[model samples]
Target: MDTLELQAKAKELRQEIIKMITAAGSGHPGGSLSAADILTVLYFDKMNLRPEEPDWTGRDYFVLSKGHAAPAQYAALALRGYFPVEELNGLRKLHSRLQGHPVSSKVPGIDVSTGSLGQGVSVACGLAKGLKIDKLPNHVYTMLGDGECQEGQVWEALMFAAHYQLDNLTVIIDHNRLQIDGQVEKVMNIEPLDKKLDAFGFNVLLVNGHDIEAIQNAIDKAKTCQGRPTAIIANTIKGRGVSFMENQAGWHGTAPKPEEAEQALQELA
Candidate 1:
């Protein structure tokens, strides 16, 4: 897909995220909105996937390490034709496959089920290593929240990935700077993030998280980055594309009321 199409799709996904949280009366919309462009580029352009054959062995794997952003991934899946878009309305419903956090078995396209802060990156490392052991050329991608980086497990996984020289693995950090508590740096400083990641043996690349073309290009480079894992630090606004929500920590986990959702949709429109 071209940049224009990806941009349009990202807007739609942002609106859909608002709808999902509103319908469910609860969710993490800030991160979901922030992650729309990254997921759009992954599903619409970069990843080799089969929407119909969700379990195809040859497909590249994606793990949403920041699982609170599942709404964004769900929107990408539904829009990419992995499932009916109407299913989005069922999000967080008692029996719906679209729960507050993604369930890999319930969702056809979800490879790694994650809601815990740092576990999914480790899972991605394992998946990448396993694929390499089996001589598969496919890659594994994982997205982590900047706040999620505070977890000790994340650093451990990075260290392990580097030790094994897992070049097929790519980690993208949603550096939106806001967490559920407050500002990430104020909550816990992880500054000089690039240097920290590099020390962990990752080939780090920084990009505008909202730039779909840049994201696609970063993935291309990650695919060819040999002997080390890649980390794309994506700088973004916390509640991107929504007028009242952008960079607001209050929206980090609050579902909008219907009127608020309407306003958000109008702004996104």
Candidate 2:
């Protein structure tokens, strides 16, 4: 898809995210909205995926390391034809495959079950190493929240990726600068992130998370990088595309009410 088309698809994903979260009565919307463009570009334009064959080994893998943003991934999966779009309304409901987080066994397109924060990237590192062992050309990609960077395990995973020279791996950080409590800096500063990643041996690229052209270019650059993993620091807004919610940390885990959802959907439309 071209830039306009990708932006439109991202709007659709954000709308679905608001709808599903409101229907479920509780789920993360801020982070989900922030990551919509990144997910849209990945699933719709970059990744080698088979919606009809989710288990296809030849396809590239994506892990939503920031699992609370499952609504965004679910929206992307449904729109990409991995499952019925109607299933999106079942998000976080009882017995729904579309839970609050990406579950590999339950969800068709999810390659890993993620929720505990900082662990999904470790699994992604394993997948990259395994692909390397098999001599496969497939690549592995994962997204992490900037707040989640405070976890010690995340650093360990990055160290592992660098040691193995997993160039097939691309890690995108949704640098929205907010968490549930407040600004990420106030809660726990993770400044100098790009420098840290570079010190860990990653080919780091910084971009505006909402800009499709920049995101596409960064991902393409990651693919060409050799001998080390590439990390894209995607600077974004917490609740992007919605007027009232944009940049508000309070929306991190709060579902929009019906009226709020209406306004957000209309804005997205």
lDDT of 1 by residue, 89-128 (tens): 9999999999888898889999888998999999999999
lDDT of 1: 0.94
What does candidate 2's lDDT look like per residue over 130-165, in tens digits? 999999999999999999999999999999999999
Which residue runs does candidate 1 get wrong by more than 4 Å?
Answer: none
Clashing pairs in 2: none
- Each prediction's RMSD over C-alphas, in Å, is 0.7, 0.6
Q: Can you give the lDDT of residue 120 in candidate 2?
A: 94
For candidate 1, the TM-score is 0.99
Q: Please provide TM-scores, in order, for all candidate models, with all chains considered together.
A: 0.99, 0.99
lDDT of 1 at 186: 96
